[model samples]
Target chain A: MPNRARFIVQIILLFLITLHARPPAAHEAPPSVRAELPLLTAPAISREGYFTLQLQSLPTVPLVVEYSTDPQFTQVTAQYPWFADFSQMTLSGFPNGQHYFRLAQAGVDGSAPNQVGPVVMVRVQHYPLNLAIGLLCFGGAMFGLLVVMIVRGHWSRSRYE
Target chain B: MSEPISYALPTSLGVALIIAFGILWIFYGWYLGRKNQTHDDFALAGRQVGLALAMATAMATWVTSNTTLVAPQLAYQLGIWGMVGYSFAALGLILFAPLAARIKQLMPMGYTSGDFIRLRFGRAAWWPFIVISLIYALGWLVSLGMAGGILLQALTGLDYHIGMSVILFICVGYTLFGGLRAVIATDFIQTVVIIIGVVVTAWFLIDKVSLASIHQNLSDNHPKLLDLLFPAALMFLFNNIFFGLGEIFHSNVWWSRAQAFRKGIAFKAFLIGGLLWLPIPIVTGFIALAAPQLGIYPPSADMIGPMVTAQVLGKVGAVIVLVVVFSALASSLDSLLAATSDLITRDIYCQFFNPEANDQQLIRWNRLCLIGLGVFTWLLCLPQVATLAALLHFTGAFVASTIFPIVLGLYHPKLSGRTATLAMIAGSTLGLISYFVVGFYVAALTSSVVSMLVCVLGLRWSTTSFRWQQLQESDGC
Candidate 1:
């Protein structure tokens, strides 16, 4: 009974040690959170369709987004207001072309913007016909082989039987 | 690790489900255990499994963690070609139909795949073959174990170790009581549950987000997903075939099932099972495509399937995903435990350790092996080191090297045992080098090609007539 108690104590200590050893969770804020500004991430070259835009920041902080086809900030095609929980958006009906987007911190106090993220580009292009043909040929060949193997097996078994 | 995400289901409900199903399965397996009177009865279920049960078990066992999580993951990562490439794995089962028939005819009294290897290729080849089989089995067991923990933590706020431990215990308890009989019987019911859960989830998802809108969304936003010529996905398509073929062709799991089915049932069971399994990945893969539409960006790709279901369908969808994944994990875990322990019991224990061990002694040791293996796997799964896809594919080089040797050793007489051993060693070495040098996608492909070259050369150089009658010799004490 005494030995059993010792074993239990050891196990508890081990568990606590391991738990303490683990790194902080991904969403936890480090000491340097005040130093590094949050950024927006998107694909460099996306296909012509709906795509997602992800915002990397503390979950508590709100951000606003602006997108446009023009490289310059003369025209703002879309705008999203300050939202905290919703960090991702799916934009659709993007014609085959290049588009630029940027994000700015929603001013907590009524004043000038604190920080503006760099502009990122997303290119939407049509599907390649050659790649499609290649996929078709490979798929067709695989199907044909499956058929041939099945038939040959049946035929061989019949002859042997 | 990220902050352990929580789903809608309460912890109490998850615990209750696990306990209730665990008890029910144990009782069912024990009831089936009443009929066992001999070693063969326990190990091979008396070799009289009918068509329906056989087909159900085959399909259920093959729809593993890879299909549930990795299928969606690939789709999310590689787009349209990912799920389509995954569906190609069903061909392994389809192609094995003829091979299963041949196996049964060649060795009617065979106990395990190891028995065949030992008989066909003397000690020279059997050693390397056993090592390869053990590595692949453990690789698969650990993958399933990790998936269980990950699935539970994602659904409820259950601790990873607790969830993983409970699942391993439940599967081990039932498998220990019933042997292969319990495994197959539970598999039939589990198959029904899985099919229903997936179909309902997909139905609700499609109804919520129409396919037309998804197409337009992808066409406008992520065109590479629909591109006919996706480079990496294309390479993945061809490479995935070799992985599946190696998994089914060499593993003792399928070999034991092939030996268990009733006369003339193995071939048809595999064929039907393959056809049923082909469409499942496609449907599951389609769910991943809806991620962009649903605005889901998961921390890890493996969680996309469950996260999408939970978000779109709410608590009810989370419960469905939980049940399907649990059932899938249990089916494959139980089979691997049964089949791998059988190999150790029959091949190593009886064939080597105790040649005079009787049927009853063999049964006792088999149970012991299961308990020991369950404990070992639980320890390994405690540390979530790698993702599901990465872990499963890492052993591709090891398993793929055995494909050619197994196929040739079964049918071709010209290939000598010495040559087979050399081929396996050389093939696996080159394959592993390529795995590190080239990429994960090419590991199996490179291994199979190298193994095939050595085998063809061996056949041309050697002349040894392996008599078919020798395969039926009773070497299992």
Candidate 2:
């Protein structure tokens, strides 16, 4: 059973990698952040590939996130806009590699160029193939039991008649 | 304050729709009431409901707003196990199928579940059973009422108080006119609406966001959600099963339905209802998984399902979600109102207040009970004390304690009244302590285990062999 489980895990991982294979797309953060609001800490990376960006900014000022693979930062890989009570943003969809993220705010009415914050580096992890297989096995067993119960119930009813 | 989220429907339109549906349902109930010649007819639908309506009402009442709203919230909070765990709740209905058959054979003339408790265990057990039943029923009612208001406000930006009041008024009005017959009949239509609306929303969601993408996204970002070995989620899986069993086994809601369904139909109807309901939480829970991918973050997790549907499908989806939620809420609110009122009328009023009360007086009292319960529920909902899930589970400690007593009492005659009473009190007290100390996830689990142990002890020592024939006694008799 363990051998079969290992094979299943390998197959799922291969399937996921193939499905997620995509042409290189630009992922970058917008340039510049208003200096008044400073980022409290660098974006923290979780085991799950989510990048949590925490900043000390006024609620009124909308924040934008910029990411880039290039250290010179000429090309932007991804951009996300954040607007809500919490000065925190959780970003996903970054491929498994080291990437740079920075917070920025576009000046109102283009009055000033984009204000940029300090850049932070984070790394995304490999897919959780083992967890996926375990979840599927559990779900499959449950549904299988349900089907058996239904058939048995109906079967018993017919015989009693 | 930040502006409330936008919705497709106008507030006036939503209000008008509720009022219109309310008036129509009440009139329909009055029409059905014309056939209600006796109190039994009113309360049990003359115990002649056929296969189709029986199955529909059973499935619809069990759906509740929880199936639509909380299933998604659970999925969002607990991951894959959350939804799969929720779908297991259908086991309650499936398991109850045979029990329903037994209930009908034992008490053909029974009025409520209280009747069974009183006959089996005497007054000592009956009192705590009533308190537990009342608390569970009222908790469910207030939660359903609050869900309606929250749904309308979420979808159409309507005032919470107005939306909440309107739903209560509508359910109370119809139930006041028709009783169980009305509740069942409305449940049939509501079931169709709920099924069609949810299927449509789910279909559109799948088309907009493929399951592959949803799977890959969760696997990528929210790996814990897909983690089968998640500790909290594992605890919730068993706790929810116990809670569902306790709710169905002990509450008058399912008891009344069992009594109302035609003789042979009760078992099959519940079986079929459980089957029909098994897939719903899966469909609903899938929507919440798409929430993170869609970049839609609701202020409250309970609101994720509706918020996601609206943002993805736009205005038309919002309308479908509103109608679906409305139907689900009404189906449950109306059933709780009808069943709980029957308990009050038969157990409290007829048994204690006036033993000489005739069928006409009892029927009138049932209608009045519905209105009074509705008002009380509305007032409780006004405070918005807790989230729907929290409020429902708070009573979990109380209801979960009844599982062992009820199952043992139904099957094993050796279970004594003293043992049953002590089990409930000890189980509930300890369960509440666990809920405060450990967490909500283990409240039902601990309560069920404690209750089971006490019941087994009673079974060992007690020598009484209860005669099933005694269950035929009328309350006043």
| Ten contiguous residues minimizing lDDT sum, candidate 2 chain A | A21-30
Candidate 1, chain A: TM-score? 0.49
Can you tell me the DockQ of model 1?
0.11
Q: Lowest-lDDT window of 10 residues in candidate 2 chain B?
A: B1-10
**Candidate 1 CAPRI category:** incorrect
> Alpha-carbon error at B187 in model 2, in Å?
0.6
lDDT of 2 by residue, B1-477 (tens): 112123556665666677667768878988998899999899999999999999999899999988988898788777788889999899889888877887887788787889889889999899999999999999999989989987876666666776887788778878888889999999999999999998999889988988888788678655667777655567677778878878998989999999998888899999999999999999988898897677554545677788789878987888788888888998999899999999999899988999899999999898899889998999999988877777888888999898778766766667888999999999899989988986777687778778877987888888888886788876592
What is the DockQ for all candidates, taken in turn?
Answer: 0.11, 0.03
TM-score of 1: 0.82
Tens digits of lDDT, candidate 1, A85-122: 43454454355688888876545443434666788788
Model 1, span B42-77: residue lDDT tens? 889999999999999999999999899889878876
Candidate 2 docking band: incorrect
Residue B42 C-alpha lDDT in model 2:
93
